[model samples]
Target chain A: MSLVVIGTVAFDAIETPFGKTDKIVGGAATYASLAASYFYDKVKIVAVVGDDFHKEDIADFKNHGIGVEGLQIKEGEKSFFWAGKYHNDMNSRDTLITELNVLADFDPIIPDSYQDCEYLMLGNLTPQVQRTTIERLKNRPKLIVMDTMNFWMDIAMDDLKQTIKLVDVLTINDSEARQLSGEYSLVKAANKILQMGPKYLIIKKGEHGALLFHEDLVFSAPALPLAEVFDPTGAGDTFAGGFIGYMAKVGTVNFNNMKNAIIFGSALASFCVEKFGTEKIRNLSSEEVSARVQQFVGLSSFVIGQ
Target chain B: MSLVVIGTVAFDAIETPFGKTDKIVGGAATYASLAASYFYDKVKIVAVVGDDFHKEDIADFKNHGIGVEGLQIKEGEKSFFWAGKYHNDMNSRDTLITELNVLADFDPIIPDSYQDCEYLMLGNLTPQVQRTTIERLKNRPKLIVMDTMNFWMDIAMDDLKQTIKLVDVLTINDSEARQLSGEYSLVKAANKILQMGPKYLIIKKGEHGALLFHEDLVFSAPALPLAEVFDPTGAGDTFAGGFIGYMAKVGTVNFNNMKNAIIFGSALASFCVEKFGTEKIRNLSSEEVSARVQQFVGLSSFVIGQ
Candidate 1:
């Protein structure tokens, strides 16, 4: 069994208060698969890139034991490239450029070997494509987690709703959850969205941390507070990747497992933000990850005598 | 030993998206003392009210086994009255009126009976007044937790710093922390603020939750996600009250105890926002508080196999 992550594997130019990067390696699938590889060995990626994508970049995934059989590289077309500048706060950013080169009419092709996928992570993409990927799979994965943003909801509400109904878990930021449910209260927002489709909802609050809601149960994960957030790019995707990757490793689907998964995911995402793009997350040691997870444990653990 | 809370004991007219209230019995000392009463029995108040404050309002404290000896009534004068309206999100508010009648020349009178104070909670008040309260104590309290706001940092920064130096723990919202430290990063802000004097600092993030920072240790407390927030006024004071109250009960001052105190405080603050002013917190049973605390424990608890 394997964990299949499907999203864009392209280039990004990012600028933050600390510094700026020039077209570094970045993408939803790249970060997600790299994060997942830390926890689970059977991690595979299905993404569309272009000739501009270097072989060394693809080799990084192989070095981490991440499968690249489904990573499509177009012969002549350039890859999708995005450039954005983050304000001093690092919470808000302005998109300077978005060149959807090879991603415009790209089709996700799941290789035959990926048929044994037990966990599927659908990163931000067109709702139709997300749904199509699910339908095309020979057998449905044991768990499906989908992450989307406000952009899709703004233009494709109908399609978004349809795709949302197919996932086992849905993850979105606090603002997107508010925007999607039209409720100012996150608890109310979670309740409304739970009825729309997914059995569980994970509302990512960035620096504030993340919340996991399943049925009548809710789990709050604390974010590791850092003196400085170097770059927040791909933190969300990395979080989702780590979450499902942990789940696949455990081979169980329950509220308890999901809670631990969130902490593990938060630990990974914490590392993702310490440097530009995937620089911090690409070369993590197991000891470093475990130590960071322990930091989270210490960050929120408290005992009260009854 | 007693927990003496010093601040305004006046009237407030609050308006939220849910509804609005007339001039109700709302004040910093009132909320803090009432919340502290649940955890510690020897809770007292030191504040100046006016003739407009009804006998029943004073009875409310007595009913909770709180000492009112230090509560001085200024005859023929109106109690400090504040009117504010919360925005739709309930995070921001606009102050419509601030009538500091009796509170303008407020003198916190520490009663002889309250001389045994061991845990002092200086609710939101003038920096000079908070310092005065500390000075008036014959012996230094084992734990001093001061709650301040951006207003003091704006106009009386020098006085604020002097007062902050006297407290063991300082609690302020995120924005106030940023404004006082001139640092956008909370971790950086906490470090700067801690250097000023306080051994510990808490940056409250309303719906996001609260963080407790000490030396190099940090504890993140999860805020109960509510379906509706009837009113947010006095929630912070209530939190401070619960925190110091728990400390007094435990008779300990350590990071572990502080973490639990924050959770207990958060549970009380959660009840505070469920209704306007102190309606919900004023009458909470011990069983109810315990159940709420347990909910908090369950909300953030997770175990990972080593």
Candidate 2:
């Protein structure tokens, strides 16, 4: 019933066609923990922030039932920051700035209370941070899910490969899946990556939908077609959060259980795109989430002639 | 139920990386009727062929439960012929040869025997011919489905618009849907085109899968992932045949019934690509078709908990 999530908890500036936001509270761990918080109350979060990291932000997490005790704030440094501008297509964008501040040199400290958490989510971070966190765990959690960006694939593929072998499931976007497996056909890509280790491979196709591959079985869950997709910043992490969070709540890792989890993930992602990073998913009502999930369930269900 | 299908019935020379076929029997109607024959025996086919059209080739349709009484054999004329080469990516092809021959000015003549048909399938043809056939039907069929290519959208858009208003459903591929509606998003294109006429829209995604849109309901059926795709020439027509054919077999036009029909169509199209120019679909045993349908049924069926 407990979860520990770790990645970057920082700031971002995003410009999309709908509008633009300057220096919003955005980061991997921020979105992940918020999404997971909806399902679990014993959610311990770990991240390195600088003096600029708001104390009121920690208070907000505490109010949302997220344990912010594990967050380590360095007094004199600035937090990691990123800015990007989206194109008309909204699928591709250009990064305008990346300032690695406190994140440039950091060490993760897993708290004693977090050791007993049954679920562990590794948000996109350095391979060493991910590997070191696993090493810090006093006992193995029930399930470990990891996410990584293409940046690490280019610089630390070997380390990434080694870390991938340790997780129960690996979640990556379509481009990263193709880049990592060197196969354009996602079916082939999933099969190739399966040989590299993880038992489950979730290839996130963004707007297209996600493909969940386990052995010879593959399930595609379509993304909800919202009229507008404002900011896509944390949609992926939000998806990962809902996927693992629902699985942890149900406490079953069977294929059928994961099918519903995938739907839940897609529903959570649909909300993420309704507004800029974390705004929609953060305040999402249980009723709203349930309705959207039911819509997805309804779209694909029908009776057949006997 | 009796069905009448009219379109190209000619010769094609196609080459793919896997193999090549020289002057093989192909055409939109040729594949369409053959696929429909599996579900209904009394199927009438109409198409124009020339003196070069092989007698034995015409016999192939007759042997497959297709009544060729509506076929027009033009004396001293050449059979319509086309040649194309597929690239590694199956999404596109380059036409090497196209001799319009009998198809240059096709005017469909519905035989008295074909007048009793309850289902009408208008395969990809000139908009004028499609419109003429609709007018030629002595009695309106219970269900009419039409398929058209992008070429008609460019040259005979007005005729195509008129043709669209007369059919119950319209089938087109992804690119064709975009061109016909002048919309980039498939959902937007489908919405725009649906306003044009047909109550239902099936946008075939080739190897990826196909989408079925009716009113506000949409269902996606994935294509079977084959290791190799030999040829994709008549797959779309084969899909339409299986689609309308199953609807004929199911005896209803409800969304639930058409949902399964899409799966059957997808399964039939999957078999069509395993060999060149309808070779695989023609040789498929009932057991093989049932087995492939079962795969699609398995791939999409998953129950979720509340």
**Candidate closest to the true structure, highest TM-score:** 1
Quality class of the docking in candidate 1, CAPRI style: high
Q: What is the lDDT of candidate 1?
A: 0.94
lDDT of 1 at A241: 94
Give DockQ per model, in order: 0.94, 0.44
**Top model number, DockQ:** 1
- Estimate, for each residue in B43-155, the C-alpha lDDT of model 1 and write its tens digit: 99999998989999899899999999999998999999999999998989999999999989988878889889999999999999999999999999999999999989889
lDDT of 2 at B64: 87
TM-score of chain B of each: 0.99, 0.97
Q: For all candidates in order, state the fraction of native interface contacts they contain.
A: 0.97, 0.24
lDDT of 2 at A25: 81
What is the Cα-based lDDT of residue B16 in candidate 2? Answer: 87
TM-score of chain B of 1: 0.99
lDDT of 2 by residue, B239-265 (tens): 999988888887778888888888888
